[model samples]
Target: MESTMNAFPVLETERLILRKVMKTDAASMLTYLSDKDVMEYYGLEPFKTEEEALSEVAWYDEIFTEGTGIRWGITLKGLDKVIGTCGFLNMVKQHSRSQIGYELDKQYWGKGIAREAMEAVLRYGFYEMKLHRIEALIEPPNTASIKLVERNGFMREGLLRDYEFNGKTFDDLYMYSLLRRDYKGELS
Candidate 1:
């Protein structure tokens, strides 16, 4: 049986809403995608133009259609602009696992927005999607991201050396994961 009740779901938290990423969200996405500070540890150069952002939206669309992943646009409750994107990647339905990824606007840093968004999605992954395990691949030096996952009950599995080639150089990342049985969050 398929795990998802709705292949695309609009997940909501107290302060944020995670919905599908649309082409119309390009401008909002560029607000962060083009920020070097936000992309510093993202393993890729900051997006240079709206065209690039549009292409990125298209890529996201394709991934959903292919069932490889689903990316959600994170927005504040009363705002129309997307402050970030978060969701599953490298999803393996048969194995009931997937890797989580996300990027938020620098302006929203220091707030608990990322944690709120991640917690909402994690619930969807474990309960709604019936996933056995959800993993995260984070650059070793990104302490904020590491803490974010750790705070949500993901355990550090190990380090993956030279795991990615980020255009200018290679990078190493830490692997973290949370199993459904190990998750302690409210599973609504």
Candidate 2:
């Protein structure tokens, strides 16, 4: 497979930019990671403060250093702050597979920002990273997120019961996947 190790590639859409996540982005990241409403469907609890966001950014850095995952801070064109993040989580190099994930600021909901970012990330994963399959596990009730992946040609695989525990309780997730053969680079 082609080497994506230690590589930080910047991807851009008409209205958004997917760039490497920097420690300096912690303050902007806090805006959404700390918002309960925005994180309701996330498997983990919302970040409690800027320190948490800083730690989260450090975690991201570690994953990148280990070549296990890569995340990009999603920023709107002309905006100085990140509105969200999207990237691979568990990447298996031997299998050419990875699990994709994203979280957006509530204020940017319904603007198709996530969709745009996902498209670029998917393209990078398939064409640039040479990944064979990219998967997403989303909360069952998150219709918006499900639709976003479906629109990108990700096929619904199955439900993973008790797939994740959000501290208080277990939750099910709908698994979705997109294969390299299925991607035609269409982002509409």
Each candidate: what lDDT?
Answer: 0.89, 0.88
CA shift at 121, candidate 2, in angstroms? 0.3
Q: Write the per-residue lDDT of candidate 2 for residues 1-188, one digit (tens) a residue.
A: 44347568888899998998888899999989888888899877888888889898998888787778899999998996888999997899999999999999999999889988998999888877888999999898999999899999999999999989999999999999999999978642
Name the runs in model 1 displaced over 4 angstroms. Answer: 1-7
Best by lDDT: 1
lDDT of 1 by residue, 1-188 (tens): 15333557899888998998888999989989999989998877999999999998998887777777888999999997899999988889999999999999999998999999999989888887788999999998899999999999999999999999999788999999999999998959
Q: TM-score each candidate.
A: 0.95, 0.95
- Compared to the true structure, candidate 1 yields what TM-score? 0.95
Candidate 1: how many backbone clashes? 0
What is candidate 2's CA lDDT for residue 112?
89
